[model samples]
Target: MFIALIALAVFFDFFDLMLSGSVTAALLTSGWSTRELNVVFLSVTGLGGIISNLVAGALADRFGRRRVFRGALLLVGLGTLACAAAPRMEFLIGARFIASLGMAAVPGVGLTLMNELLPVAVRGRWVSASGVISTSSLFAAALAGYLLLPWGGWHWMFIIPGAGCLVLYCLTAVLPESPRWLATRGRHEAARQALSKMHIDEDGPLLALNTLERSGEAPVDRLFTKALVKPLVLGVVLAVGFNVATTGFLTWLPMLLLERHLSISNTLAYNLMMSLGIPLGGLACTMLADRISRKAGIIGAAVTALLLAAAFPFTSGYALIGTGFVLQVSMGVLSTLIMGLYLAELYPTNVRARATALSMATVRLVMVFLPFLLLTLLNVAGVVGVMAVVVICLLVIVFAMFLLGIETSGKSLDRI
Candidate 1:
């Protein structure tokens, strides 16, 4: 039940993030002018998201996770509503960034809350299982955009997720705080209050965690302490590495496909087909998360993604579709399963949200300008050149996992 609620909170974020590329394409297909500015709009919105994550992550730590999480949700709803009502390309672009600002914090805040409340032994699997929910929503949203754009157009796409967010915001406005966060702040009673809300048995190992209350140390300062620097540094690098593939590439994929001589309908069709792997990879991660070492799984996923990405130029028909399926699945592992769970597990409760944000911020920064670079690269080197870059980035991910990966398997968050 607790996990279900967290999943519900994440649903809109997943939907909104995946919708950007399709939305851009949809707007173009609908005869909206200014094709050059669409990429800029996407980049600007991504920039807004990065800024929001950095601010919200720290604020969630300083204030409270539940409050910050709910507030972010409300913001996303507002952005979505604004988007639906946008009168022109300019208004839609501004509305897009407004929505991104609020939606940015969901992953970090949700990860912090989930890792803090759930058992350490099954934390990886539980988080990965939650990816099933998120990725499913992503696929659904993308497919919905694909189908709806031909009929009702882009306006309704925004409305669906926006309405979903408003309704969910109303329903889950008041949720339990993270007990680990409460304990980290030395609020024992508040910690117990959190547990009571979750209905977690009081006799569990949660109470056994030592609440190390260090006064006066800033949250960001704590993240950079000697013990955390390795994870922090590697996490930020891996975070950037991960984005070069999914958020960087996939976000621009629809337009890229159009550049490759595919029709808009065909582009959406391929995307709808490729999106099948989101849940497929998520489901695999759910099964393997606790069973295999996360480090091994991450390495494997990167290799798979690299190989499939490299094959894009040579294949078509079912072969192309197959590669696309596997590519998205592997990317899903890098994205939905590993990134969030890995970052959250690397930190203690006190600075977990901040660390998660700081790490994710690196990716968002890369992705903020990714559209411009991607367009330039496509013009100069074509899709194959872009794939080469993606391959290099995946290599970086593999090496980062080897050097800085922490074995969090079956271990408590406090012990990490």
Candidate 2:
């Protein structure tokens, strides 16, 4: 069941990564003017992610993880088909938002559900596997682009995945709910029943629930309370820093390659090569997640990112490819580490999803302005110089994680 859910969630999570490389082609063929397409379609995509994540997090806390999990898949499937049939940019935008709600819900709640189900000893491995699944889907999406674009164009790109999501929704209903969430809601029998399905009979850990009860009716604003401030601030800052560097570099790589006198096909090939590097790096990091300190892993990955970003602009051929490989590996690892454990560590079970949502939302906001900023930076500073600035931001993240991040390996979600 765990393996199955991870596969389903990966299909949903990285569908956006697949779309990113091909969106311009899609927009050109769709016949919507740039004015309508940019503001409406892109805005809906970003906003849908933010709103869906926020709502899913809240619903996960108030109801249970499975409630949001099931609902999210249905929403994504419908949204995908809606996007396929979109007659105008506005209609597409709305449908994308609906799909995004389902898309975003999977991560925050899915992670929570996985953590709840697994014992601490294998928790890191479980989360790391989830990361690999997500990143691997990214590589697959790129492959899909290479194969599918010539035959069916963008609509089929979405149509196929949308149909796959429909099948996943059926599979999702058969999976067990989070026993931890059931226990907190005081449904002891239900919790036990769910746990039995997973072949466990022991009562689940109660630290998270006990902590929430002891906190005793604290207002939602307390998410930023003194004890929470360090992790919250660090989490948000690190999220923004990472996204700026990542989205900036990956978004412009093909154009950057073209500027260096490479042919268009070769430039795309390099990009595909980099995309292929993602899963390899992600898998390496996942293997160590259980063995290494989360903070140490993240700090190592950040410093490596800084180095890779600085090096990326100077080399080409084997050297450029080597640098891109290292950077993607580190970025893949750190992103998985941070998303898999950092947010889960920062907030107790009761508020974990909400806290993660807030940090992710801030990242999305930065992404909104990043495209133009990246273009300006590339024009002004050249690729090497732009990468240097990215390295500096990554340096800031290294410092933040070292000072403010918490170690979460083998810990209970509720205690975190």
Candidate 3:
């Protein structure tokens, strides 16, 4: 039940992120160009992402995770509905940025809450299973866009997740504060109350009744102290690299196909097929997330993504779909299960939300300019050019893992 609620939170984010390729592609078919799409439209969304991360992270650290989480969902709901009613290109981009900001606010608070609340032994397993629903939002967006674009036009695509967000926001009322977070803030009564709600006794071996132990560390203003610098560097690098690799590739896919002369209907179908890989990848992680160390899983997935990306531009038809499926399957594992979970565990509770938000913020800020770089690359080379950048980033991830690898498997968050 707890995991299911968390899945609801994860679902809205992917629903927000996944709609871009198809939604933007529909606009392109209606006459938006490559230059206009990137410089004018997508840039706003990128800017929104940056703002959301910084603001949301700080708010959660100061005010509390639950409030920020609720506000973020509200933003997504309202922004998405506004997007559906947008009258022009400028309005659509503006509304989308607002929605993106809401969804963007999620990772730090939402994942932090999850890491604090979930069981130690099965944390990886639960996060991986939740990822199945999260990543599958891409497929849902694609299929919804594919089906409804013909009915009420592409405008209706934004409405689906808008409604989903509003519904989930209401349901989130049932969630509790993190006992770990409450304890840190000198709310021992609240902490105990929250823990009691989870039905875990403090004397249990699982918690060792030690949910209240403090490491006596000073408050963290910087994400990088000497002890944290290595993992922080690796986490930021990996976040930037993986996002640039997959989203950078996937967001441009529809345009790439259109540029290659595929018809709109076929382009929609192709992207839908590609989106299928998200859940498949998530499912793969569900099986392997606890079985292997996260560092190994991430490294392996990154290498596989690089290989699949290398073969992407050359394939056609069923083979093309197959390649996309496998590529995203690997990325889904790398992203949702390994990297997201690993970064949260690397930092301690005091600064966990802030650190996670900083990494996420940096990733989103870098991604803001990705469309510009991708446009330049497409002009000079093509899909292969984008893949070249992705491969380089993946290689960086491999290096980061080897340099900063630390196993967090089966360890309590408090112990870490």
Model 3 regions more than 4 Å off:
32-34, 203-222
Worst 10 residues of 1 by lDDT: 210-219
What is the alpha-carbon RMSD of candidate 2 to the true structure?
A: 3.0
lDDT for 158 in candidate 2 is: 74
Sort by lDDT, top down from the best = 1, 3, 2
lDDT of 1: 0.79
Name the candidate that leads on TM-score: 1
Q: Which model scores highest in lDDT?
A: 1
Off by more than 4 A, model 1: 211-219
Q: Which is the winner by lDDT between candidate 1 and candidate 3? A: 1
Residue-level lDDT of model 2, residues 1-416, one tens digit each, is: 66557555655666653465444333543444353354345455556777877777777777777778778877778788888887766776777777877776776677767777887777788777777877776566666655655444657667766877777778777778777666656677887888789887666454236845445323568678888888889888887787667665664465567568775456556667777777776788767988888888888989888887887888889899778877888878876887666766677655666777788777766655655565567668778656766887899889898777787776766656
- Model 3 has an lDDT value of 0.78
Model 3, TM vs. native:
0.94
10 residues in a row with least lDDT, candidate 2: 24-33
lDDT of each: 0.79, 0.70, 0.78
